[model samples]
Target chain A: MAETIPLEQVLGTWVAALLTLAIFSFLYRDNPVYKIAEHMFVGVSAGYGVVITWREAVIPDLIQPLLDPAAVDLAGPNYVVLIPGALGMLMFSRFFPRYDWLSRWPIAFVMGYSSGLAIPAAIQMQLLPQLHATLQPVWPAGEVTWWMALSNLLLFVGVLCTLAYFYFSREHKGALGVASRIGIFFLMVAFGAGFGQAVMARVSLLIGRVRFLYDDWWMTLVAPWFGGG
Target chain B: MRLQIPLAITFLIGLFMAVQFFVPHEVFQYSFESLLAWVRIVGAFALVLGIGSLLRTHWDKIRRRRRDWPYSIVTIVSFLAMCVIGIGFGHEPGTVFYWVFENIQVPLDATMFSLLAFFIASAAFRTFRARSTEATLLLVAAVVVMLGRVPSALIVSFGDTAVGHYLHANMPDVSEWIMNFPTVAGKRGIIFGVALGAIATALRVILGIERSHLGGGGGGGQ
Candidate 1:
């Protein structure tokens, strides 16, 4: 007896392969096939976003707590959810000419809350930690290797020079000019490393698509004829 | 009244969010959590507004019979179909919605991003000219990091040879050092500036000085 491949698996592989090829068609030139795939992508993504948001945020956080018996019992029937829900609905006011300004209220609330929440977080998470790390003693009270000490010294100076480069208040001339020049070198290296990492990530994704096309799509189609699974 | 009320709401909400961080009281904690939940609910509603805008744009395009208008039909149909399937049938595993997402959306999304690999390579070829010292450093660093990140066996074919063995041992270490030290320094400097700028802008927003979010000349009057 021979094993059978499921119809759903076969159909899915075909669809995925075709879509992958459709996207890859752009590498040749912009064409209708690619445009169709792109439009489908946009539509599917938007629909998926709505579904996920409704399920994860609105239902569990807002609707269930408001209406569901089990959820109401757990959270004690909170009516505060109405405020944000109303604010959210108010966002649709942008569609109406007379009520367009009403949209600004929710915008203001979100912006204000986010901005306020960010201030202390920025100070605590980014500023203080970075400052402390940069300001560390190059020659600590322990037996430090020459390379370790050199690395620390370079880091401290590099950070200061980079900061100087960004300091547009003072004109870059004399010592400041030299420091900023060095800062540019460090920045370039950092950017290059970042670009390299990004390229590697994209390449990995490309490889994944290629593997899917070959292993899942091609193999599934041809393997049955070739007496392979 | 409209402008003043929104501005007042902004100030009060912003102040409360900021001040609540310092207050460890149970009431403040509870209120903070509730406020966060409200943010999430509001954000979900905002997503609906976005979808509505998308639908309107596509509908207009189709109605006008604009260039590529047929594609708009595809988008609108797919959007509605997915939404119906997802909402009506539920999006859990084994459902048609989940299958569509797994087969259609996932493949489309992955392939779209994977296409960037080719574009980025093309871009690098065009822009990575080593015309100056900084450019040379960038080119060198990029090449070194790219090569170093790959598996040692792949890059160093003659791993049994002395030079190849040395490279295999040290290439990753060198890449690690570059990322750990210079990258950290450069990124930290940038972060410091950004953090300070963000704090200043947030304070401005909280104080009603940054009224650009209000739209239309950012005037106080409606």
Candidate 2:
């Protein structure tokens, strides 16, 4: 007996294949089929986001605690959860013209909390660590290769020049102008490398999609006709 | 009263959150976790508002019979169907919702982004002109990095000779050197500037100097 594929699975493969091709059709030019696919993509993405948010955030954080506190390892009916629940409900005030201003409370709370949190985070995570990494000694206390010293010198100078380029408080004349020009060179190289990486990633994704269409979709369609499982 | 209260709330919450970073007390730590939970809950509501706005826009388009109005119906229907199936059946594997996500959403998302490969190449072809010295350097770097990234490019045989072996051994090293040194330097400079700017902006927001988030039309009262 030959193996058999389920009806739903076959249908799903066709649906996926068609959608993939529909998106690819944009390469020729925009058309109704592409428009339909684009619109469907937007709808599906938005719907997916809503469902995930509700299940992951709202249900576990807000609703579950209220309904069955024990389910979430709470010792008692956690009334504290109601604070966020009420704040969330307050967000609906935007729907009404009279109470719309009330929505600002929750918005303000979120914004204030995040902004406050970001201050120490930016300093601790980005500023201190990056500065420490950049300011390393070119020639350490031990034996070092000339190439290592040269590489360190280039990095230190490149960073200083880049910073000089960003310093717009003073006019770029003479020494500053030279540093700025060097800075621009470093920036351009970094940007080019980034662009190359991005192009590679996109190309890899394209290859994966093409492989799926060829290996999965096409094979499923033609395998039965070829007397293969 | 409306404006003042929110501003005060913002300042107090912002200060507390920022200050809690330095505090090692268990109470502060507990409060920090609780506040973060509140933020998540509130953020979910914000997403609801966004989705509501999206639906309203499509609904209006269909009602007005705007250009490509029929397409709006497709969006609305697909959105509702996904929501109904997802919320009703749950998103676990073997469910209808999972099937829709795997077949419909994943393919659409991947194919849509993969199309960018062609678009980016076309864009680069048009804009990557070597008009200036900096532009030439960028172009050269991009080409080198692109070729160097592929292992096969490193193995280019010049009649299967010694030169080919040297090139094969050194190409990846040169690429890695550029990325590790010059790239790191440039990125560190950028990060320093961004971090300073972020701290300043956060402070301004916490102090209520940045009242733009409170919305427009004379709510800028101190």
Tens digits of per-residue lDDT for model 2, A12-111: 8889999999999999999999999999999999999988887888888888888888889997778898998888888888777677788888988998
lDDT of each residue in B1-222, candidate 1, tens digit only: 878888998999999999999999999998998888889999998998789889999999999999999999899999999989988889999998999999999999999999999999999999999999999988877877876787475345775688777777788888888888888888888999999999999999999999888883232246
Least well predicted 10-residue stretch by lDDT in candidate 2 chain B: B213-222
Clashing pairs in 2: none
The per-prediction tally of clashing pairs is 0, 0
DockQ of each: 0.68, 0.68
The lDDT for every candidate, in the order shown, is 0.88, 0.87
Name the lDDT of candidate 1.
0.88
Could you tell me the lDDT of residue A71 within candidate 1?
Answer: 63
Identify the runs in model 1 with alpha carbons over 4 angstroms from their true place.
Answer: A1-6, A72-76, A139-144, B151-165, B216-222
